[model samples]
Target chain A: MAELTYREALRRALDEELERDDRVFLMGEEIGRFEGSYKVTAGLWAKYGPKRVRETPISEEGFVGAGIGAAMLGLRPVVEIMTINFILVAQDMVVNHAAKIRYMFGGKVGVPMVIRTPGGAGAQLTAQHSQSLEVWFAHVPGLKVVAPSNPADAYGLLKSAIRDDDPVLFVENLVLYNVTGSVPEPEEDFTLPLGRAHVAREGTDLTIVAHSYTVRRALAVADRLAQSGFEAEVVDLRTLRPLDVDTVVESVRKTNRVLIAEEGWATYGVGAELAARIGRACFDDLDAPPERVAGAEVPMPYAKPLELAALALEDKVEAAARSLLAECGLVGSA
Target chain B: MARAVDEVHDVLQDGEQALRLLRLMLLIRRFEERAEEQYTRARIGGYLHLAIGEEAANVGSIDCLGPDDYLFTSYRDHAAALAVGSSPAAVMAELFGKVTGVARGYGGSMHLLDVDRRFLGGWGIVGGHLPIAVGAALALDYRDVAGAVLCQFGDGATNIGAFHEALNLAAVWSLPIVFQVINNLYGMGTSVEQSSAEPELYKRACAYRMHGERVDGNDLLAVREAAGRLLTRAREESRPALLETTTYRFRGHSVADAGKAYRTAEELASWRERDPIARYAGLLREHDLLDDGQLESMRKEVADEVSEAIREAAAAPAPDLGGLYENVYGDERWREQFERMDTAAPFGERMETRSWQS
Candidate 1:
């Protein structure tokens, strides 16, 4: 194992995928020679040459659609949007074409494309750059949405996404890029299965389900809960669309209480989907109704205080978990 | 008239191809006319945009393409679909929303797809398919294939964000995609002059540092020649080009409207005089390429073919209800999941309970 930052792990995954498969390539603004807008593709152009590492103009819709077209022709294209905000320009291609092609064509073709974009709010990038639009993509049927919370999962899930036959929306949190973790040693061929959740920690009192940046927050909250004599299990949902509801339901069955955390707005977000699924699969297993600690329902405010209040933090997760435990009559007075 | 004679002399292939172009234009015109009648009779549902007056533009531009080349167009696409060799019957079946339709009636008039014929689709949203076409060109170039993408859109799309994005990407990548603008004067109700800052749509291609040309859309010979040259250049050199065919639409944006809200009777009559089929037929007679009898027979044959297709499509059954859950994913696991869901109590009960309050 080698320690790597989230961004470096992503770059390493791209390099390894390109090396392993000649058909795999990367295209986006500033991804070649100039590195990347976030430096996630630094040194890739020099290593693979311009043919594999392509630099596109600031035409998100065009390049994204072009990626789909290339995918249709059996090329695996990893398209990088600078941020989730710029992705709006290409939503029609992502939502209408990439998401519906397989279904509309009756499985005649597959979109083996990975659209990677940095998402979530925290970097003082203001409202436009900070919105979490993963739910919008997750709502689409034919597409897969994956969000990796750390370095290892970033490398693992990205390789899986590149090799997968379906279009995958690989979301990265801007705040987690510099965070470091041990990644598997570089290999010519490496892939991790998609739609599987990883149990960050095993506990018996309550199950905390989260993804991306929220997963880190949940881990922190779980640690804090342990200090308070409460054991909280944390499940990091690396892939959102396929959801791995079985793992989540199994965890809920073991714990009998669940708390869903997401960085997006509370209503109709990932949390709502998880809550509904848990309600369906583990309604009897649940000791209390599933609680969701999600970002407040509004555009991310610019003010620091309001922004802090809007996001789903460790405090919110801990509080929601405590309330669930109390409702289940499992926790004594705090 | 002399220019017309000169263009005809330049590209006319034994006069049969000219007759073919005239025949195709007439077929599209009559097919759309019949579609209009069906829409009025409520046999066709949803938005029914016609290409009645713009048949020459569609046929002329498509005539330039090789069999391996691809074609993409906007919603008003009956003529383009036919010109690219989609059977008139399939086109009619599509308008009638039959399961035998090109896209199994799921596409209706706006979305038409024939992958084998290399006709990508007729996208409903303005300027939406432009980028996808450029992408297809990119794919062709990546595979080292000698083909270009003929992407047709209306004048209104020129001002949209997708037009700029697609053109810029195509120019930067030097992809073999020809951006064909069939400027039918109005974008639904909005005129070109009103929507676009630059009314000369062809000139906008220069902004992307790509080649551009303007041709008289009613002049089928000119459109074919220009498109042929541009497509050749694109296929040979892997370069992007834009061709603006200044055409007119005889009908309203759709079947419901009489098209009176936008233009005057005199304007309509003047455009009608430049009818692509009539003009091309007149040229064929002038050159002794086609006689009145042959033209009449060609029209009758095309009409009969379309009628037969309609009859067959009407007899075809609707798509199987089981297909509602089909094609959502490529994996068998997903199919199994869908099957499990189908077997579960219907989604109505579960969905009703989870419906968003807002």
Candidate 2:
């Protein structure tokens, strides 16, 4: 087994893929000499040279669209946006061209490109930088959206995202870079399938479904509940687009109670979609109505406490889980 | 590289090439005329943008492109497609949204494409495709591919942010591409003078320190000359350039636009006087390259071909409805992934409905 930080996992995936395939290259602002805004692409730029580790100007629409065009011409381009919030500038290209090219062209060509971007609010980066827009890309049909919570999944899913034939939005968490976990050994042939959910902690009392950073919060809440003789199941939804509803329904069937945690607004969010599907599939099995724990519905403020309250934190996940368990009449005895 | 003025003289001396340019321009004119008629007859739906008066700008620049070059354009693309050798019948069939059309009728008038020919697409967004076109040029540079890209758009696209970004990147990267602006006087209804602070669009290329020039788009031989030279420079030296072809649309922006609201009849008549087709014909006659009989025969041949295109397009069948789910995803695994979302009952209710059974 090999241990790696979330940021290291992402870097390893990029390094391995660039070495494995010559067609794979990178394009983004400050990604080469600047070593990325997040420093995830630190040494790879020095190793790959200018052609492979291509640097771009602060023109999101220009560079993102260029990536799509290169992909159409049979090259695998991994485009990195500084953050998901800045991706709005290139939304027209991402939504209209990258996602719709293959379908609009009647399947004549596919845009095999990966857009690696990070989202989530915790770093007091103000309203503009602090935002979660995974649902925006996941809402689209042609793009595949994947957000891995752990270091291992981050490494495996990114490798798969680069190899995927269609355009993939590889969403990452801004705060999970320092977190570490054991990845498979380099000698072991390991690659996680997209659209699959992982059961991080198995329990019988309740099911807490989440994705990205929220999964880590939910797992911690599960561990806390276990101390009080309450068993809580945590399902980390690794992929959002080709959502694994079957695995979620199976978890809901066993637990008979459901709670969804998301870092975005509650209305029309990824949690909303998951709750809708779980409500429909496990209606007869659910001991109580599906519940959600999400961030405050306003634009993230700059204040430290306000930002903390506005973000999806561990305390929020615990309260939501406890309330759902109480409603299902399975209150744990401390 | 061939100088712009020298190529004009060369085109004049070569009677065979001059006649071919005249024939293609006539074919595009005839095709657009028939396409407008079909739109009125309800054979074609969606927006129908015509390039009736801008024949030289469309035909001349595209004439310089070789089999190795890639071409991209804005929505007013029927003329460019025809100039690039897509059959008139297939183009018309696409407008009809028939199964046999290019893009399989999926992309109608605004989104025509022929990937095999390297005419990437006719993008619908105003300035949306410029950066994408730049990226294609970057790919060519990266692979050291011996080719260049021609990105054609209307004057309206110049005001957009993507346009500026694309030019800046193309200059910085030294991508092998030419950004051809077909200044048709009006971006839909707003004139260039009213819209741009510096209405001389070619001069804007100087901001990126790239080569830029303006040619009288109505002059067929001149447009062909400048475009050929610039394209050669791009492929040989990997230098990006901007070529502005100042032309005009004879009709309104689309078929629905009357085109009379903003401009007077006198202005319309003035542009018509400089009709690219008639002007080219006059020049060809002056050079003893074309006679009245030959011009008449050319017109008759174009009219016949356009008529046959309409007939074939109208007869072609529509794409099957069962394939509604097709082309959405390239990977075969998507089928199994989407299968779980499928339920015979509405609202995800798997229970069998007894009302129909009863």
Candidate 3:
């Protein structure tokens, strides 16, 4: 294993996949010469040349549909939308065509396309660019949504998504790119199965469920709670659509109290979906109602303090976890 | 993989090929009539858009395509499927929502595809398929292959954002594709003149500096000529072109529309006078290629074929309900992937549930 940043891990995965498969190619705006807005595709265009690492005009709907078409015709296309917000312009292509093509066409053709885009806040990108809209695609049946919270998962999950036969939405986080961790070496071909939740930390008293960048926040909260003598189990949901509720329920049943967290709004968000499912599954084992902490339900502000307030950070999560533990009569040291 | 492609000039001179073209158009006409009857009889359901009055526009351009060429069309796709060599029984069975249909009853009348024939889809959305067709051309260019893509849509699709994006990409990249707009006068209920600032749709290609032209859609040879020319250039030179086939639909956009609300009877009568099949048959007769009683026999033959197709479709069984989740995802592990997602009994719901809340 070698240490790499989350951005480096993703770039390494793309490089390896490009070398591994001739059908795999990249398409997106500013991905080629400009190297990408966030620089995730830096050096890829020069390495792969213009054909394999194509740069498109600011035509999300065009290129995304083009990616679908290419995937339909047996080529693997990895389209990069500069950010999750830009994907809105191509929402119809994803929701209607990419997601529905296989079933709608009666299994005649499948789109093996991967749409990669970064989502998250904290650099003052404001409301539009800072949204976590992965749940919107997750709510659809055909799509497979994967969000990696660290460098290792960023490496493994992207490799799996590139090779998967269906349309996989690979969600990256802008803030996590510079974060470094150990990832498998190039010759290992290390890959992770999608739709499985990883229990990042094992604890007994409370369960905190989260995904993507929120998982990092949850883990930090778990660490803070450990200092207070409350061991909170952190269940990082790697895949959102084919959600590994079995793992979450397993954790919830053991802990008896659960808190779901996200960077997106709580209403109809990933947290809401998990809360409903957990309520039904762990109804017998519950110590308290499933609680949730989400980003403030407002357009993210430009001011630093307001942005910090808008996000569901570790402090808020720790407070919510402590409150749930207190209700369970398991209060710990301050 | 390079093979000789026939131009419209050569095919137009061949009498036997001309007769086959006439027959294909007749077959589509007969198939649609039965489909309309089937819809009213409650045998077929959903939005059924027929190419009844625009047969030449559908068959003539599609006939220009080689076997290796890919096809993508909007909702008005019955004739496209038939013209692409999909069997009458299979097409009819699809209309009947039977298991044996081209798309196995899943893609009703609006969505039909014969993938082996390289016909990608008969998509239901208006402007959605254009970019997909352009992508197919991008694939061909990427693979450095010999085939091209032909995307057919209505006059309505020209106004959508995807239309502009698709054309711009095809032109910018010099992808091999022919975008055919079968302008049947009205986009459902509205006229092109009322909807578009520039009523002449072909000129829209100028925005991308792409080659564009218009043809008399009711004239069979005219459509064949333009499609043939553009498709050849697409295949040989890797160029993109827009061909507008100006025609009229005798029936409404869908069977639900009475068609009388939007247009005048005088206009309909005038178009009926220039009916493609009748026009072609007269032309063939004048050239001494068609003889007395030949047209009647061809009509009789096609009518019988369509009737047989209808019977076969009617007798065919509907798809099994148990197989509803078959094609949603293509991964081999999709069953396992979705098994966990089965929300009915999330882990402990069925395991001796703790009262109603469980």
Candidate 4:
């Protein structure tokens, strides 16, 4: 096993998939010669040449739609949208065309394409550049949405997404790119399955549910709570669309209390959906109502302190966990 | 199997292939006339956009496509579907929303697709499918596949951002695709001139550094020749181009409209006088390729076929409600995994068969 940065792991997945399948090609703005805006696709252009690692203009709608069309014709086109903010321009293509093509055509063809974009808010990159929009894609039925919490999942999930027969929205977080985690050796062909969640930490006192970057914050928050004698479990929801509710419900039953944490807005967000589902699935097992810790309702501000305050950081998650425990009388008084 | 209808006979000195093309056009015209009647009788529901007077543009352009090449069109797709050799009965059943329809009742009048025939789709969204067509071209190029894409759209689609994006990408990538703008004068009620700054839509290709041309869409032979040339160049050289087929729509945007507010009777009459079928039949008569008897027999055959399609479509059964949620995702495993999330409240139950086999 070797520790690799999330960015390196992603690049390795792309390199391996490109080498493994001639049909798998990259298409996006700044993905080839520009080495990607986040440098996640660094050196791919030199390695695979322009055809496999194709560079596109700032035309998200055009290129994204093209990726769907290419996929329909039996090419696996992994398209990068620079960031989730730019994905809006191509929303019609993704939802209307790619997602609906399979069903509307009565299963004649499938869009075996992947739309990879990063959506998180740690950097002080104003309102537009920094916003978590994975929930938007998750709300869409035809799309498979996955957000990996670490490098290993990042590598495995991306490879699986490329090989998937249906359209997938691979959501990446800008802030999680440099985080390090141990990945399996190249000789060991590793791929995580979609529509499944993993329990990152095992505990019985409380279940802290999260996905993507929030999983890291939840683990850290769990560690802080453990210091004060609260053994909180963490459930990493790897796939958001075909959500692994069974896993979340299992953790809730074990803990009898839950706190949902997310890096997006709480209202009508991933947390809202999870909370409602948990309320039904873990109705009798719950010691208290499921609580949620999420990013501030306002659009992300540019100021560093304001940005940090707006984020769903470890402190906010810890606070939400502490309140859930207090409400259940598992710790101190509310 | 034949690349173009013209190539079927190097010495159509006899005009057998020409007569076949005429028969196909006649079938579409009669099919559309019956479809209008069906709509009036409340057999077909939803928005019905017909390609009534655009038969020459539809049939002529499609006659140029090789079997391997792909075709995509906008919602005015009954003629396009017929020209592409889709089952007339199946297409009519689709308009009737029956289970035996081309799309199995999933896609009504607008979203027709036949993957077996390489007709990619009958997209309801105008200009949205342009980039998709370019992507198909990209796929063919990547795989070294021996085929190209033919994307047909209306005049108003030329003014959209996707039109520019799709053409520009096709040019930059050197993808093999021939974009056909069947400029039937108006998109819904907006005329091409009032809607597009560059009403001469083929010239819009100059912005992308691609070849562009316009043809008299009412001239069947002219349309076929121009389309065949552009498509051949696309397949052989990976050169994308724009072919503007200037025609007119005899009906309104949809079946609901009377098609009179924006157009005058005089304009309509003048265009009708230059009817493509009549014009082609006149040419055939002049060359002694077809006689009055042959023409009358062909019309009678097409009318009979149209009547049979309507009869079959009306008799076709409705789609099975048990399979309502099929194909929402390509994988059935997704349904099994997500079934737990289906709430039990009113209107919250997922529309999936508990056991489709039973």
Candidate 5:
């Protein structure tokens, strides 16, 4: 295994895919020359040159539609939306065109494309920029939505998403970019499948299921639980659309309690979906009523303290997990 | 379909070409007449847009497109699909929502596609297909191929954001595409004069500094010549252009609309005098290229063809109900992704089904 940051892992995935297949190309605003607003595409423009690593004008609807068009004509385009907020402008192309093309076209051809964008809050970027809109895409049919927590998953899932036969929305977390982890060494052709949940931590006292940046927070919360002699198994929901209920349910069955966490608002959020699914899967027979820890339901505030409070912080996750264990009458017993 | 203009020069200059063009237009007119009847009979469902009076605009532009060209059109695409050589029976089957239809009854009248002919789609949204057409051009350019894309939409699509975005991208990238606007005056209920600030659709190309032209859509040779030349320029110069074909639709926005709501009887009568099919037939007659007997026989032939299409489509079975969940995902991994939705036994045993079925 080799150590790499989440950003580096994503970059390597792009570089490898572009080098491996000529049909694979990148298109987005400032992706070339400027190297992307987040610098995720740094050095790709120089490495692949202009045609493959294209720099698009700030026309998300145009370029995203272009990506869909190109994918229709047998080219695999990995389009960057800069951030999730910008994708709303191109919602028609993504939801109506991209998501509906495969089914509406009667299975004749499908878009083998990937739309990679980051979504997260905490930088005090305020309401518009800080929102997590992954659930909006996940709710759609005919589209694959994946959000990897670590560098290994970032590398593996991005590669798999690019190579997939349908349109895949590869969501990244803004805060998870600099987080480092050891991805398997190259040349092994190591790649993870989409829609498989990974057990980031194996424990039995309680199960904390989360994804993207929330996975990191859940892990930190699990560590805090360990200090209290409790073990919280953390299930990283790598793929939201094809959520791995098998893994989540199996973990919950062992722990008898679950606490779902997310960086988005609790209502109609990932936490909400998972909690509902878990309750349905287990028939609401859990130790507690499947608790949840989510970011504040209001629009994210710009102030630092307000931003921290609005986020699903580690303490908030720990508190939720502790309450669930306490309700199960196992808090002090642990 | 990618043959050079000179390759078709002899045909266009002779009576054989006149017969070919007239036959296709008559076929479109006949097919649409049958489709309207089918809609009335309740055989066809969903939105049904027809291109009756704009036959010349559809056929002329579509005929110029060779094998190396890709085609996209607005929902008023029955004529466009027929012009691209999609089997009349298959087009009718698609309209009839039969399993044998072009899109297998999934995408009925508004979303016909002939992947083999490279007729990408008949998009339901007014301006949505423009960017997709531009992207197809971008694909051709990326492949360094000698091909171009022909995107057709009505005057109503001009005001949408996607239209401007598509045009700007095509111009900035110098991609190979021809944006043809069939200016039939109205975008549903709203007229072009009501919707666009600049009613001159072709002049909007000047904003991108691209070549723009307008042609008499009712005149077969005018549209054919303009589209053919522009498509050739795109393939050779790696440039994009805008061509506006002025025509009028006899039907309303869809078959549901009577078209009398916004148009005057006098205006309709005036446009009927300039009907594309009639104008072409008159021109052919003036040149002694088409006689009344030939026109009658051609009409009879087209009528039989469309009648056969209708017979087959009506007889064809509806798509299987089991196929409802198919094609939403084009991958083996969909089973894993979809297992969570299955409440029974959770993820007992999953199986991967078809992938795009292509």
Candidate 6:
């Protein structure tokens, strides 16, 4: 096993799924001959041919609907929208049809489909390109939303998404693509369970709960805090919809303080949800009120400085951690 | 045994089948009339979308389908469901919100599902069932099934995003599906002319690069002829087609609507004059297919059958409370798993052990 970038691991997951199941295929804009918009399906077309690694026309609604139809007929279709923002075009197919089919039919049928897309801001892709919609999908009942922060988890989660018996919304952060980690060699049957959070780093003073790119930011802040003698635990909430609040509550109970982080706008984002749930579940255990480090409320700005200001960077997360420490009466001692 | 196109037409024009279509249409008209009465009395809950004047369109289009063919429709689905072989008792029970109803009383007037009859569902949202119908057609083609899907929606749905997406996919893949648009002119309160750029709804099908046909929906024979041809083409060639049946709804959109706000009383009278049942009865007499006595006897027979069904459905028991959580998840174990997780160790217990270390 060798370290693979987030994009490379996603490619490996698609490659393995395609090889293992003849029915499994990838369809999206520029997925075939052009590799992928982000190279997540770079060499898959060459390996699997046009039929399996399909290059669809730029009709998100059409292709996404077709993928759902294909999945209904027992085909394992992996539909990729270039980004989460583009998925809004196919909201009817995703929310109304794919999410409601199994229940509406009295469980007679199931839509075993997967929609893969990149999300969040940091690359300065501007307003239209960089919105975080995990909370929107999470609000929906039937959809299983997963946002993987690193290469290993991306590989594991995508494989599981393709194989699951329900529709899965698999979101990858655009900025995490080049960052690498050790990915196991492709196996015939490899799948990570959905609705589980991983403890990326363990500490005692405060628990940092985050998903996608914010997981990395939280970990970096934890590293910096470690140097200053404050032990900050980090929890990577891989799946946003089926929030693994038990793991979060457990971490908070041990740490006694919490810092929630997300790349979405500050109001009503995933971080807001995490903080609310923590307050409800472990109210008595809290040493301090939960702190949230989130992106600015404005539409993601184009100018570099504005974009930088709009995002909750490592410094903000670090400051939030220090604030939590201050409330816990550990800042001066640390 | 592949038959010639002409032979298929000849087979469809049998005396028995013709009578069956007429009977089905008559039954639907009477059933809807009864439903309207029930809705007026406040017996039926939720929206009661009546498919009154559009009987010919539903009967003619559904008559072209085989037993294996799938059918999905919008909320105005009582006629469509009946034509697809769902028992009148079950449909009436569904309207009554009884447990013996289709979907076990879960889905009310808008969402009727009968998997056994291949009646997919009556989706509540306009244009919502379009993509689902396309998906079902794709499933049929992938499984090598020799059937097509008839997706019924109103003219209003033509403007929605799902309609464009579903139709485009159907065209691209050549999926075996028929987009049956019952153009009764109004989507809720908005007229087709006001909502759409093109007054001819059939022409919108051309945008998806699929074959489109406009039939006089008031004429059952014409609707049957066009539907039969297109459905045959869909089954044999795996091509999608859109068949718009231009008709009018004699009643308002729902029972509560007077339909007077949007349409003139004279216009409503004009459509009522071209009622599918009355028009077909006149045609049968003109062709010496049936006399007045036969038609009258047939009407009485249908009325009796509808009455019996209503009585039975009224007596049917309500759904059991224990079955509430039955079909929420695919696996039964999710209930146990959710329960176990809900009752797991409280945060207080875990915090006590860590307090000593602190």
DockQ winner: 3
> Which regions of candidate 1 are displaced past 4 Å?
A105-110, A186-188, A302-306, A332-334, B1-13, B331-358
lDDT of 4 by residue, B48-74 (tens): 998878999998888888866999999
DockQ scores of the candidates? 0.49, 0.61, 0.76, 0.65, 0.69, 0.41
- Report residue A280 deviation for candidate 3 (angstroms): 1.5
Which model, 3 or 6, shows the larger TM-score?
3
The Cα error of candidate 4 at residue B183, in Å, is 0.5
RMSD of candidate 6 to the truth, in angstroms, is: 4.8
Docking class of 5: medium
Query: Model 5 segments beyond 4 Å from truth?
Result: B3-12, B340-358
Model 1 residue B172 distance off true place after TM-score fit, in angstroms: 2.3
The CA-based lDDT of model 1 is what? 0.83
lDDT by residue (A1-334, candidate 4, tens digit) is 7899999999999989999999999999999888999998999999999999999988999999999999999999999999999999999999899889988887789998999999998888989998899898898868899999999999999998988889999999999999999998877879998878999999989999999999999999888988888888999999998788888898898999999999989999988888887787678998899898899999999989999999989888898888888898777422
Taken over the whole model, the C-alpha lDDT of each candidate is: 0.83, 0.89, 0.91, 0.89, 0.90, 0.83
Would you estimate the TM-scores of all the predictions? 0.93, 0.96, 0.97, 0.96, 0.97, 0.92
Predictions ranked by DockQ, top down?
Answer: 3, 5, 4, 2, 1, 6
Number of the top-ranking candidate, with lDDT as the measure: 3
Q: Please report, as a residue range, the 10-residue window in candidate 4 chain B with the lowest summed lDDT.
A: B344-353
lDDT of 6 by residue, A60-126 (tens): 8878877876676678889999999999988988888788767665566667889999998888899
Interface RMSD of 4: 2.0
What's the TM-score of chain A alone for every prediction?
Answer: 0.97, 0.98, 0.99, 0.98, 0.98, 0.97
TM-score of B-chain for each predicted structure, in order: 0.91, 0.94, 0.94, 0.95, 0.94, 0.92
The fraction of correct interface contacts reproduced by each prediction comes to: 0.42, 0.56, 0.70, 0.70, 0.69, 0.30
Of the two candidates 1 and 6, the one with more favorable TM-score, higher being better, is 1
TM-score of 3: 0.97
Model 3: per-residue lDDT, tens digit, A1-334? 9999999999999999999999999999999999998898899999999999999999999999999999999999999999998999999999999999999889999999999999988889898879988999999989999999999999999999999999999999999999999999999889988888899999999999999898899999999998999888999899997788889998999999999999888999988888888888789999999999999999999999999999998889888898898898888987
Give the per-residue lDDT digits (tens) of candidate 2, residues A14-114: 99899999999999989999999998899988999989999999999999999998998889999999999999999999999898888777778888899
Deviating ranges (above 4 Å) for candidate 2: B1-9, B337-358
